[model samples]
Target: MTWRLFRFFLFQLAGASLGRFLFRGSSPTQGAILGLLAASALWVLIDLRRGARLLLWLKRGETAVPARVDGLWGEVADRTWRLIRAREQKAADSEARLQEFLAAIQASPNGVILLDKNNRIEWCNETAAVHFGFDPKKDVMQHVGNLLRDPHFAGYLAGDDFLHEIVIIGPRSTASRPVRLAVHLHRYGEGRKLLLSRDVTALEQAETMRRDFVANVSHEIRTPLTVLTGFVETLQTLPLDDEERARYLALMARQAERMQTLVNDLLTLSRLEGSPPPGSSEWVSVRALLTLCEQEGRALSVLLTDGSGKKHDLRVEDAADEEIAGSQAELLSAMSNLLNNAVRYTPAGGRIEVRWQTLPDGRAEFSVKDSGPGIAPGHIPRLTERFYRVDSSRSRETGGTGLGLAIVKHVTQRHGAELRIESQPGQGSRFSIVFPAGRVRPLQPV
Candidate 1:
C-alpha cells in the first residue's frame, strides 16, 4: 500500500512538472489542477487494465498458475487461485470415492441398480445386468418397466407400496433350468429408487423337496399300517380255521416287517444327513466288504424267490486287494445296498455281477451290473433323491424302502468317492462307486 501511495504521488509530481514546462505562462493553480486530473485518470486506467487482465485469465479457465501482478489485483489473483485448486482437489477426491463405491457394488453377489425419479435406469452392477439380461451401456436411461416387462415386476414398480419384496422368473429362466429372483425396491433421495435382487432358485427347490418328502413318508407308512389293521380286524372278528389263521398271521408279519424296513431306511437317511462325514482313519478291506455283500445278496435273493426253485446267477469278483479308509459299517452298507438293489431288480435266473477292482488311475471301484430293465435317461439324474423310484409298484412288490441309492450317494460323498450310473433301455444297468487314490491303499500281508 505504501509503495502504491508513493507511486501515485510520484506520477502526480511528474505530471505537474510536465504541465508547468508546457505552459510556462499559465498560472500555478491551473497547472497544479491539470496535473492532478491527468494523474487521477492515468491511475484509474492502470487499475482498469489490471482488472481486465484478471478477467481474461478467469475467462480462459485458470487451469495454469495465475500471472504475477502488483497491488490489490495481485492479492486477489493469489487468493482466487488457491480457492480454485482446493475445489478441484475436492472434486477429484469425490470422484475417486464414487468409483470405489461402484467397484464394491460390482463385486457383490446380489444385484444392485440405481434409478432416477422417473424410474429410468441410472446405473447397474454387472450382477444386475446378468439378472435382468441387460447390456449395462445400452440399458442406461431406459425405463425399468420397459426393460423388465414381467407382469409381477411391472405391477411391483407401479404400486406405491414397496415394503415387501417380490419373486419373479428371471428373463433368462427356462422350464428345464429355472432361475428365480427375489427383488425389492427402496425409495431414496427425492423420489428416486434402489433395486436389489437375489437368486432364490435353490431355496425354492429345497422347500419343494421338503414338502414332497413329508408327503411321501406319510403315504408309505399309511399303506402298510392300513394293511396290518385290516388283517388284525379279520383275525379278531372271523372264526378262521387253523390254516387260514396261520396264513393271516404270516401276511400280518410281512406287513409289519415292511413297515420296520421303511422306518429303518428313514432313520438311515436322517443319520446320513445329520452326522459328520466319514473319516479316513479306519480302513476296511475290500475283500471283507465283498464277503458281506455276497452273504446278504444271496439271502435277499432267497427271500425274494420265497424258497422257489428259481435263483439269480449272482457272481462276486474281488480282483483288488485294497483297503478303503472309512467307517466299516457305512462302506458295508453302501456296497450291500448296491448289491441288494441288483438282486431285487433283476429277474430270476438273470446275470448279476458284483466286482471290486482297481482302476488304471490308481483308484478302486465297487461296481454292480445287473441284467434288469434299465432306467430311462430322465430318471437317472434324480435316482439318488430320497424315495425316488423308477417303478414304484415294482419297488413296493420287491419290498424296497426306496432309500437305497440315496444312502449310497451320501456314503460315497462322505468317503470322497464318485458314484457313476450307466444304463440304457433293455441293456441293463451298472452302478459304480469310484474311490479316489488317496483313500485306497494296497492290502498289507498279514
Candidate 2:
C-alpha cells in the first residue's frame, strides 16, 4: 500500500515538474494542480485496464494468471485461480465417490433405483434393470409408473404410504418359471424416492414348502393314528375270537410300522440338513452297498406281494468294484432307499435293474432302472421335493413315506454327487447318482 501511494505521488510530482517548466507563463501552483488531476486520471485508466484483463481471464475460465498484470489485480487473479483449482479437485473427488457408490449398488444382489421429484427414472443399477427389464439408456427420465405398469404399485405410489413393501411378478415371469420380487419405496430428497427390490422367489417357495410339509406330516400321522384308534376301540368294546384278534393286531402293527418309517425318514432329512457334509475319509464299498440294497429290495418286494411269489425281476449288478468315499451308514441308507422305491413302485413281475457302473469320464454312477409305469415329464423335476407325489393314492398303497427322493437328493449333495432322474411315461424310469472322480476310487494296491 505504501509503495502504491509513493508511486502515485511520484507520478504527480513528475507531472507537476513537467507542467511548471512547460507552462512557465502560468502560475506554478495552478499548473501543478492541473498536472496532479491529469496524472490521477491516467492512473485510474491503467488500473481499469488491468481490472479488465482479470475479468477477461475469469470469463475464459483460465487456470494461468493474466500476463503483465500486477498490483491488487494480480493477487486477485492468482487467488482466484487457486480457488478454482481447489473447487475443480473437490468436484472431481465427489464424482469419483459417486461412481464408487454406484458400482457398489450395481454389484448388490438386490435392485436399487433413484427416482426424481416427479417420480421419473433418474438412475438405476444393473440389478434393477434386470429385475424390471429396463433399458437404462432408453428409460432415463421416463416416468417410473408408466414403466412398472402394475396397478398395485401405481396405487402404492399414489397412496403416499411407504411403511411397507409389496411383491410383484417380474416381467420375465411365466407359468412354468416364476419370478417374484419384493419391492419397497422410501421418500428421499425434495420429494424424490428410492426404490429397493429383492428377488424373493426362493423365499416364497421355501415358505410354501414349509406349509406343505406341516400339513402333510399332520395328515400322514393322522391317518395311521385313526386306524390305530379304531383297532384299539374295537378290541376294548367287543369280544373277538383269537384269529380275529390276531389279524386286527397284525393290521395295527403294519400301520404303526408305516408311521415309524415316516418318522424315521423325516428325521433323516433333518439330520442331513443340520449336520456337516459327509467326508471322503470314510470309504464305503460299492459291492457291499449293492448287496444290502438287493436284500432289502427283494424283502420289500416279497412283502408287497403278500408272499404270493409274484416278485419283481430284480437284479443288483455290481459291474464296478469301486469304493465311494463317504459315511457307510448314509450310503447304505441312500442306496437302500433308491432300490426299495423301485421295488415298491414297480408292479409285481415287473423288471427292476440296479447297477454300479463307471462312466467313460472316470466317474462312478449308481443307477436303478425300473420297468414300472414311468413318471410324467412334469413330475420328474419335483420328485426330490419332500412329500411331493405323482399319485398320492398309489404312493400310500405302496406304503411310501414320500420323503425318499428328498433324502436321496440330500445324501447325493453331501457326497458331492449328482442325482439324475430320466423317465418318460410307459418307457420306465432310470434314477442315477453320479459320483465325482474325487469321491470314487478303485481299491488301492490290492
Candidate 3:
C-alpha cells in the first residue's frame, strides 16, 4: 500500500510539474482525467496487496477467509469437523466391540484358533492352549504344522478335502484319561482359516461302551440259546434212550440257568447304576457275612468234589468279628461270589484262603485269595466287566456266570469299598475287597 501510494504521488507530482512547464494554458479537463487515473491505479494496488497477504496467511497454517458470503465457509468447516469426530468415534466403538468378542472367545471351553493366509496362527484362545499344550503368547505367528506334529493333523491340514471335520486323540490322551478332540477347519476371508476343536472324549467312550455292552449281551444270550435249540431239535427229531434224554435235559437246564444268571446280573448292574447312593442303614456283622459265605462255599465244594475228595479245598480264616453298616443282602452276595469263584477255580489240592480282617486304619478288608490259574495282567483290569471270562470252557464247567466279579464290583462300589485284583499268569490270583473305615461299625456284644 505505502509503496504504490508513494509511486502514484510521485507520478502525480511529475505530471503536474510537466503540465505546468509544457502546457501553461492547458484546460482543467486534463487535470481531472489524471486524478481519475491515479485513483484507479491505487485501488488496483490495494487489491493486489490484500490477495498476497491472504495467500501468505493460508500457507502459514492460518484459517482461510470465506469464499462466499451467507456463512457458506463456516458451514463447510463445521461439517468437516463433525465428520472427523464421527469417524473417530466409530473407530473407538469398533475397537471396543472387537475386544469384547475376544474376551468371550477366551472364556469358551472349546479351543479356537485363527489362521492367516499363510496358514500361520494369528490368534488363539486360552482353551486352545490347554487342548494343544501350547503357549498362547509365544506360539503366535508360528506355523500350525510346526507346533502340532501329529501325523493325522499334518495330513488334515495338507489335504484338499476339508469339507468334513476329523476327530483325533489329543496330547496327554494316554495318561490323562484319554481326551478326544474334534477338529474343524473353515475357509474365510481371502485364504484365511478358522480352526475349532472340541473335546468329545466322554461322548466317544460312552458310545463305545454302549456298543460293546449290546454286542456282549447279544453274544452271551445266543450261546445258551444255540445249545437249547440244538437239544430241542434232537429231542424232537430222534428217539433217544432215557439216560441220553436225561443228560440232554440236564445240559439244557444248565444252559438255561446260565442265561438266567447273566440276565439277573445285567439287571443288578442297571439298578446299581441308576439307584440313589447307598445310605447308612442296618448294621451287618462281617463274621455273620463270612459264615454265610462259608456255607455257600462248602456247598459249591461238595458239588464239585470227586470221590477222591481232591477236587476242591476251601479254607476259612476268621479275622476280627468286625461289623459294617450296609445292606446285609448285598454284602452277603458279594462275599459269597468271591468265595464261590475261589473254590471253583482252585485246582485239586490247591487251597483257597478267605480272610476278614481289620486294618490298623480301621478299614476292613475281605480277601479271598485262590491258588487257581492266575489271570494275566491285562485281564485283571477288565475282570469286573460283565461276561468277561479268562477261560470260557472252565467258566461253563464250573457253573460260573461270568458276572460274579461284576456283582462284587457293584456291591463294593455301593458300599464305598475298593476292589483290588492282584494276578499274574501261572501264579494264581488274589481278589480283595477293602471297605473304608467310615463304613465299618462297632460290633455289638454277643
User: Which candidate leads in lDDT?
Assistant: 1
Candidate lDDT (C-alpha), each: 0.91, 0.89, 0.82
Look at candidate 1 and give me any clashing residue pairs: none
Please provide, for model 3 over 1-446, each residue's C-alpha lDDT reduced to its tens digit, 9 standing for 90 to 100. 57656866776666555545544467655665565566556655765665555445446643333322112233454454466567768988999999999999999988999999999999999888888988888999999989887889889999877899899889767863788899999999999999999899988988988898889889889989999999999999999999999999999998999898888877877877788767876788888888889999988888777664675667788756568888887888888998889888888778888988888998889998888888888777788887789898898788887888888999999999999999887788788999999888778786
Q: What is the TM-score of each candidate against the true structure?
A: 0.86, 0.91, 0.72
The TM-score leader among the candidates is 2
* Count of backbone collisions within predicted model 1: 0
Q: Which stretches of model 2 miss by more than 4 angstroms?
A: 11-42, 64-68
lDDT of 1 by residue, 176-287 (tens): 9999999999999998999999999999999999999999999999998999999999998999999999999998888899999999988888888899988877788889
Tally clashing residue pairs in candidate 2. Answer: 0
lDDT of 2 at 225: 99
| Superposition TM-score, candidate 3 onto the true structure | 0.72
Model 2, CA-based lDDT: 0.89
- Give the local distance difference test score of model 1: 0.91
Better of 2 and 3 by lDDT: 2
